[model samples]
Target: MRSTSSFFHFLIQKCNRKTRRKLKFSKELLVVDSTKIIVGIGQLPWAPLKGTRAGVKLNVAFHPSVGQPHRVIQSTGNHHDFRSSEELFDAAIINVADRAYAKCKRFDEYV
Candidate 1:
């Protein structure tokens, strides 16, 4: 099996290339969301108390046009979904996102 970093790198490159080539003007829509994974550090100095722990976030960019996920991205735990929107989809592409991504700047710039 390939290393985790290598696999993710390949995925990112493939997604970027695909998005650049075929993400043209269409009546399609894309959705984005993130999932969190917790990691235990065994009482590290910077660890959160009680319930919280170090974690990784999986930020996904899904094309709802086909009723299946098209592309996905994984980011650090602290990265917000909107902060990576531009990198997830091509510029000016139509995207359908939840209220968390309804910022005016992103809508004005990429919608």
Candidate 2:
């Protein structure tokens, strides 16, 4: 089994796709969202969420055109989407993001 930490990295390296050199982000959207799998608060105190809930966050960034998820970065429930994701901006392709990724400073740099 592959390590969870390097799972995404392994896919990018071995996935059957030319993500680079022909990335067309106009048809691709960097959809970002997190799902919570609530767990026992006392059992896994490390994964804290709203109120007394506790769980981990599954943060995903994908290219719909390529039919492959470019990134799947995980974080504790409390972590914000924008801060946890990579700087997903490319001059050659369009980068669409939601309100969570509305960082002016980062956007300026990306542009």
Candidate 3:
């Protein structure tokens, strides 16, 4: 399992470097969204969503020009999507997200 994880980590780093090189001259734009993944309630007692279901959420920050996700954050399905925005957003880059992330305080802080 450790070897597999190492292999994937190296692969991802290689891909990210290549993508960065290709997009060096292009402007960076990040599109963010969250997707819920369902799991067995018995398998993961920690990720309870409702009475009978268990799941996890993946918050992804994607670089459309590079066709890859630059960042991913995982949380329990019950976690709010907007809460992950705080970690995904970079003050210098323009971030595009849906209404789920539209909190007035967060908007004002970015200004």
Candidate 4:
């Protein structure tokens, strides 16, 4: 936990040092998005939002270059982004997110 910055730096540095197998263009940066799954109110009563509304959300950040998931978070749908967002990286690896995330309170820190 204390070495978050160093860990991120080391990852980027290692990625940069990897040997390229062929002549092509690739993005080393990452992209992020969120999705939701609706669950029956009876199954997930803790996330209730009136009537039968209840669900959970998944936030993911992935590396475009290697097609690998770099970070992920899951939380009750009622809590929203602010409550579920975790620090994905310490390096500013050109994260591309939608405008909704751009306006979030903790979005600036990642960049």
Maximum-lDDT candidate: 3
Off by over 4 Å in 4: 1-27, 82-86, 104-111
Q: Which is superior by lDDT, 1 or 3?
A: 3
Instruction: Return whichever of 1 and 2 wins on lDDT.
Output: 2
What would the TM-scores of all predictions be?
A: 0.55, 0.59, 0.71, 0.61
Give the clashing pairs for model 3. Answer: none
Q: How many collisions between residues are there in candidate 1?
A: 0
Greater lDDT among 2 and 3 belongs to: 3
Give me the runs in candidate 1 sitting further than 4 Å from their true place. 1-26, 42-52, 91-93
Ranking by TM-score: 3, 4, 2, 1
Residues 1-111, model 1: lDDT tens digits: 998557544544544445645865445455566666667745342533336566666777776445566667776666677776666664445565567655787557644
Model 3 residue 38 distance off true place after TM-score fit, in angstroms? 1.4
TM-score of 2: 0.59
- Cα lDDT of all candidates, in order? 0.60, 0.61, 0.76, 0.63
Runs in model 2 lying further than 4 Å from the true structure: 1-28, 87-92
What's the lDDT for residue 14 in model 4? 49
Clashing pairs in 4: none
Between 1 and 3, whose TM-score is larger? 3
Which ten contiguous residues of candidate 1 have the minimum total lDDT?
41-50
| lDDT tens digits, residue span 1-111, model 4 | 748547554554444424323323253566666778787899989887658878888877877566578898887876565443446532556565655454555556546
